[model samples]
Target: MPSLNPASRERVLVLLRHARAESWGETDHDRHLADEGRADAGAAGRWLAEQGLVPDHALVSSATRTQETWQSLAEAAGWSLEPQLDDGLYSAGPDTVLDLVRGTSSEARTLVVIGHNPTVAYLAQMLDDGDGDPTAAADMVMGYPTCALTVLTFDGDWSALDLASATVTAFHVGRA
Candidate 1:
């Protein structure tokens, strides 16, 4: 993990959509990551490491695919932190997920959240302050596919986070 100055007020939030999964499963939450998904997730982890975006904490969906994605990504990134697996994230909408993010501990300078589809995409769009990397923002607007991740930077505490509070610094769709 990257060392953060204790007095720094800036925070980084990484939003990641779970990697691709097999189409058929006993239940939606039971599906595990496809072989390709595992490779792609590793690519995403490598990218995060290259960018020095290691997380101090992580929030992951309890769904099998999301759990698998986090495992693969963490392995590639050499992340040792044990993620908090939240059942709420499995079914959460953007607003609900935002509330969960707001509840994050202030001590965490960098936080990552791994979850599912539309919610992750919508949350990435919703959090943008519209004043960061234009190309990255454009790519995010174009589409958020499986293994897609967005990096955002914001000031102040997590409790104060709200719509348009953060600036999107980077975006990537990992593939391998």
Candidate 2:
């Protein structure tokens, strides 16, 4: 894994907000990503790949939009990864998402969560120690737009994760 600081043991987490989707009168769970959303998600994946942040594990929401977002990103990045779709992620709150994070396998050095907001957005802000890239932090503070990716670094194991336990290392707003 790429390390920002070699002296400190770090666990990386990438939170991705589902890309833009069209409701089209479907139920919230059935909403699918729009064309622009697919492109945006692809760009986000490419950005991660370029940064050498390939996820060892991905937790994705079972909702249609979230699934589409992950699929687009994985394909664009040419990743061989397969995400675990959980029903619990559908409209989950920060605490619930945190639990899912805490349960991550120890062997997986890099983890990603692709879901909805304001849970994903709120969690990023909550975990951030305000010690990373200022411009990236500012973009996150503004709000997590469609396909936005927030990269965080924690000093401990996943089971020890909690509010303010990590620092925002990088943030990217995927291109449309």
The per-prediction tally of clashing pairs is 0, 0
- For model 1, residues 116-171, the per-residue Cα lDDT tens digits are 98999999999999998889899999999999998988889999999999888889
Candidate lDDT (C-alpha), each: 0.92, 0.88
Q: What's the residue-level lDDT of 154 in candidate 2?
A: 87
Candidate 1: segments with Cα more than 4 A from true spot: 1-7
Candidate that would win on lDDT: 1
Residue lDDT tens for model 2, 1-176 = 23533134577899999999996736889999999999999999898888777788999999999999999999888898999999999978999999999999877778889999899999999998877777888989898888998999887888999988787878888895
Clashes, model 2:
0
lDDT for predicted candidate 2 compared with the true structure: 0.88
Model 2 bad stretches (over 4 Å): 1-8
